[model samples]
Target: MKKEYKIGLSIIGLLLLVFTFTDMNISNAVYNPESKFGLIFEAIGEFPSAIIATFCTVSLMLTREKDKSIKYNLGTVGYIVLLIFFSLMASMIPVKYLHGPKALIPILMAIYITVSYVIAKKCATTHKEELRRAAIVGILTFIFVIIAFNSIKFLWGRERYRHMIEVGSFAGHSMWFIPQGFASGNEFMSFPSGHSANAAIMAWITLIPTFVTSLKDKKSWFIRFAILWTLLVPVSRIVVGAHFASDVTMGVTITLVIFTLLKNKYINNLEEKDAIHMFI
Candidate 1:
């Protein structure tokens, strides 16, 4: 592993450890509706993920050969435009009138994945290696992260922030404490956050091309954008009453760990010409 990667993971691990001990206090700090900032973050956190997926998928299609860059770039731009239009339209619908942001976003993500998969598969006729590897990483990242999060959630059986007696619930426990036999029968499944997991996966998805391009050519804007999205979504979930601080902290950490491991494996498998790990 690279020095930076190791250091990054270590920092995330430390934060996870610290948050595990202070989950309740942290949750309480942002739990108040009066905070007001969380509403803004929640409203925009998931904004451009599908557009990003489109960009990544399109970039994979425009491999070394095949002079289709113009068309693909235009297509990606069009996708972004449509995404912006839909987002504005969706915002017009009141939050109370909608079913669930969590559920709806995943459904949209699934659609984006399906579209990207089809495009990549079609373009694989010429750009086999790039498209295949990108798609494989993406599919695996999605499956592994979601499964890992839900598995822990099912086994941990922790309650959400508002559900705990700190806010208002008939039967509740301390959010900071983890106890034995805490593995089942809790209706709230809030130990680790699924929305935060989504944020991590989105970051990883966008990161694939960035890693494949050039380690030395790392784009600062893209890195900042990815980091901002990853930070905002999970925090929004915690503030909006869906998860506790520790839940999102652990969720993001687990997703990054899995994503980094998988990305490293893929980098290792590629030929020397495409070996990103060598430089890192």
Candidate 2:
């Protein structure tokens, strides 16, 4: 069993390394908002992600956690991944690279799967109860995110993109048109990359619920993949050129902050008395 586990992890690691070195559509970033944003985010995500991870880890430490060896490792790994991803997303560095989309996204999936699995399995709880709780929490949080995001969408209407890049000033210069995220045609939306927002909201929604269950089981792996499914929609938006590098940035920043806060402040205590009811 131990040998197989080691071998499996080794194989996964090797695959990630291979993908890391593989060429990217690095040139694709020239006008592609998605690729451009992906590059920038891949560069910058780590700083904030690491801060988020450290906060969570510190939470555990402050409480004097015992029997938490695995969760600690999982959070530590998540921290490391954010750091590494930040480096990899830099397209401006100008290294010639060629990579298959298949290769890149799978490595991302691996990270999600790993985090979800460690959290689900290593944390103590009844499997059925834990799954149910995670499901409920995930569902509720996701709904709220979508509603809130859309409401923000409606509330901000045509002016939101201004907040995104401050386009009205020349100052109005804070914008990207190739991705077409501006309210130009729509005139009611702009500011955040809705495509990126959905993707990030999905990621947060997916990750938090697992905290209700700890994301450490084989079944949880499937759930993690489901969350990844959310990424595809955003990638599609970028390909269509409706979002810009800055828009995606703002969108993700919004998602990460909201989701992480909700997860730690509330979802972390799902097993505690009547917390799930709070979702009501």
Root-mean-square deviation of every model: 8.5, 18.5
- Candidate 1, residues 1-280, lDDT tens digits: the string is 6899889978877877787777767767777654466666555554443344454444444443445689867866774564444433333322323345655654654565566556555555655665556655654665577689888887777777766644566355444346324555444688787767767766554544433454325556667777887888888777767677778888887778877777666644575546666788
Q: What is the TM-score of each candidate against the true structure?
A: 0.64, 0.37
Whole-structure CA lDDT of model 2: 0.43
Q: How accurate is candidate 1 locally (lDDT)?
A: 0.62
User: Which ten residues in a row are the worst by lDDT in model 1?
Assistant: 88-97
Error of 2 at 261 (Å): 2.7
Who wins the lDDT comparison? 1
Q: Candidate 2, which ten residues in sequence have the lowest lDDT sum? A: 89-98
What RMSD value applies to candidate 1? 8.5
Q: How much is 268 displaced in model 1, in angstroms?
A: 4.4
Q: What is the C-alpha lDDT profile of model 2 across 51-85, one tens digit per residue?
A: 22322332232233346588877766764564344
lDDT (0 to 1) per candidate: 0.62, 0.43
